[model samples]
Target: MAGGTDAGAGAAAEVPGLVGVPLLGSLFDLKSDSLGTYLRAQHRHGDLVRVTAGPPGMRAELYCVFSPEGAQQVLASEAANFRKDNAFYQEVRDSFGNGLLTSQDEDYLRQRRLVQPLFTRRRVDGYAGAVAAETASVIAAWDKAPDGVVDVSDEMTHLALRAVARILFGTDVEATAEAVARCFPVITDYVLRRGYSPANIPRHWPTPGNRRAAAAMDELYGVCDKIIAERRGAGAHTAGRGTAAQDGPVQDDPAQDSAVPGGAGEDLLTLLAAARSSDDGEFDASELRDQVLIFLLAGHETTATSLCFALHLLARHPEEQDRAREEISRVLGDRTPEAADMDRLPYLTRVLKEAMRLYPAAPVIGRKAVADTRIGEHTVPAGADVILAPWVTHRHPAHWPDPDRFDPERFTPEAEAARPRYAWFPFGGGPRACIGQHFSMLESVVALAMILRAYEFEAVDTEIPVGAGITLRTDGPVRCRARRVDG
Candidate 1:
């Protein structure tokens, strides 16, 4: 961060870029094919490329750092120079308010401190049976599917939502989960279009897009309110009992709190609902609502898509699918998976990592430059948006040999050790990385193992159509059938 601008200042101006038709620059190209555009530019322009786009006369800049060196510069080494901005931040904040993902500085730090305890190994290990039980129940419902043709995307979505609802909030808001399922795609689509496009449309404009987004938010907020009210009704002191006031940290054997509506265990919402600050002010209702809403979406949607993509990839590659199923069977031997079994199922972890490489849960990591910084030979100006794309970086031929091929061995300890850390960040790097990474990984491993153990899925169609929204997801239903293989 200390390097003078004189070093790479001129190089920044000379950095190679994509030629555009007009003020829209690469905006149109992004609309047609975003992944293709980024990869193509990374190939032609090397690691540092400046992307600019806007309406006819306006030009907005979005700098892309593709190489691991550049990624390190922004994410780890010089992270202080780059901070979350109002660009994408404003839009995300509008949705979840001041939750963990969108907050910065002291406010973010405080919220992070409060939420981090809820995801520590001690807390997360207690949610495995909840995840496994939900997985079993889902498979049972699949047993009722007439021909066993199931939508893996929808199925995974419900599984993740139920898990988050039951484990995180300690309640099952089924109707809200259903509402998010119905309304989220539209909301994600709207967010992406407005976030990237040169069009500066105000939310209060009441355009068709605005109206649809508003309606969806109403449905989502209605659910959030209900969840908050219920948790608050349980008495804050009761919810806060076992959470924040831990007697230091302690390890334990595998166990899950049967934290359902009628269960005796404490939930995240209940914990926060009961929490009070040093000054004796109780946790604000809005903060609880904001954080819970974030956990619901993040804990549910991203993990669901990751599982869906992993299943899709496994089905496409029979060798990998069989290998994964075999590992699950050998490890559990007809018994359901417990959190402890995760260590024994290395292949499943590799498959999940490989799938994440091909289809990262969060595709693009965006940050704003708080100060001028030198990324390799290019000196990026302050106020610019720095974009680190896992989708592009993971597949870049330089870092990954035969990057397009689906091979889980790429995640072997030896292989991972040989590469740069930023080369494989499904969860964003640095201090602001995802708080739910552990919970997500555990849930995916358990759920993927459970699904493959009881049933094998076959691709209805070999072709995959990908989409980019709040999360990178399959464009349509991932149609596959569940064939029972267990006695």
Candidate 2:
């Protein structure tokens, strides 16, 4: 492929120089509505477009290619040249340390090898029961209210947090749910705002929202630390000692309880404790702490946002909602769905897929090129930021017919097989793809099935505006009425 060559076949006309002003070039337009701006850029410029930002004229490139050939090249063929951008990684590192989400290259490879097994299909399936039980408990609590309006975002956040707490921490932690909820806006706000502003402020400084976020993070970590302490205290004495250490007296530190025998605990913390690296190295306390924070934020918030949007979509499109309900009813009959039933609920899965396509939780995945690379006919300079947007790709007319329309059939095996591999990347693609993809899919299937089996959703406010930050969400509360369904 010739760099800078106009491959006129599927290319839009290239604009000379970068789009937007220096220091803030296209930043406002990009941030205002990411998907819309991306589409416009692709239509106006070409598959590859240049954007400038920062005071010293830092330039980045955006690609909105829906072609199978282009998608494959970026996501797979030239993956080595592309890596997560420093700005995004720095934000996560500030919050999560150098855990899996923020770690690069060799560190990422090592962490992934150790953590990948935990998300295997079998292990992910094990979490279905916990997802179902948590969904049921949440619905049961909601049943106490009589035909009232509920904020779907708030409700979903609470449900996801509770589910993660029960399954990942082995502690209900219901009392702290309110406190945890308060932390998200602050965290999200700081992250999004900092992306545009160049100033770097320490978390310890008494800034308004930053201080609250720091406190909330402390509260969140405090809960995890307490759980770790409890487990360590219980498991310390019985923890296995190697044959060479038989002569030594055992220390009474509760922290050693993480080394307990038999892998007895159900919490993710315990699993992390018991998990050994492929090379047999164990995660130390700090590593374990960083992972806990990463999982807590990544596991719940995105799933919660997706579920909220799914419900909102169902509310607006009654026919699709009916199909989902019918599928749930027929698949499970009268019993609650188990892991085995997930494979049988194809329509439910399709509905969730379409929901994610229409309203992706994480709108875009970004990368920075480490070396000069040619994508199609364009030679992207080293240090240029590259973005793969699910929000834009899922709505691209070239891949999806009536791209803006909400249709579940697009996810049917035949329909899905017809599109490019990266055409509908809600959770991303390739080696660095989301490790929790299966887990999130299973969680959504089980939760949506359980909800549909009991109630029919109706839209109370059809005009609710969509918003974005870490996840695509409703601007205001998603008010909806849930009517009981006859069994």
Model 1, runs deviating above 4 Å: 1-8, 11-13, 245-265, 276-282
Best by the TM-score measure: 1
Q: What lDDT tens digits, residue by residue, belong to model 2 across residues 222-290?
A: 766766677667763233422111112223333333232222465556666656633536666677677
TM-score for each candidate, following the candidate numbering: 0.92, 0.86
Q: Candidate 1 residues 1-487, lDDT tens each?
A: 1343344465554667777776578978877777778888898888888887767565677788888777777877788888878466677778656788888888886676666555667567667878988898888888888788888888998899888877755555566667777877777777776777555678999899899999988888888787777666656566523444223333331232223322454766676665544423445778887887778768887899889989988888888899999999888987878778878999999999999999997877789987788776677788888888888999978879999899999999999999988899888888888888988999999999989988888888567787566678676788887788857
In model 2, the worst 10-residue window by lDDT is 241-250
Report lDDT per candidate. 0.77, 0.69
Give me candidate 2's TM-score against the actual structure: 0.86
In Å, residue 467's CA in model 1 sits off its true spot by 2.9
C-alpha positional error of residue 230 in candidate 2 after TM-score superposition, expressed in Å: 2.5
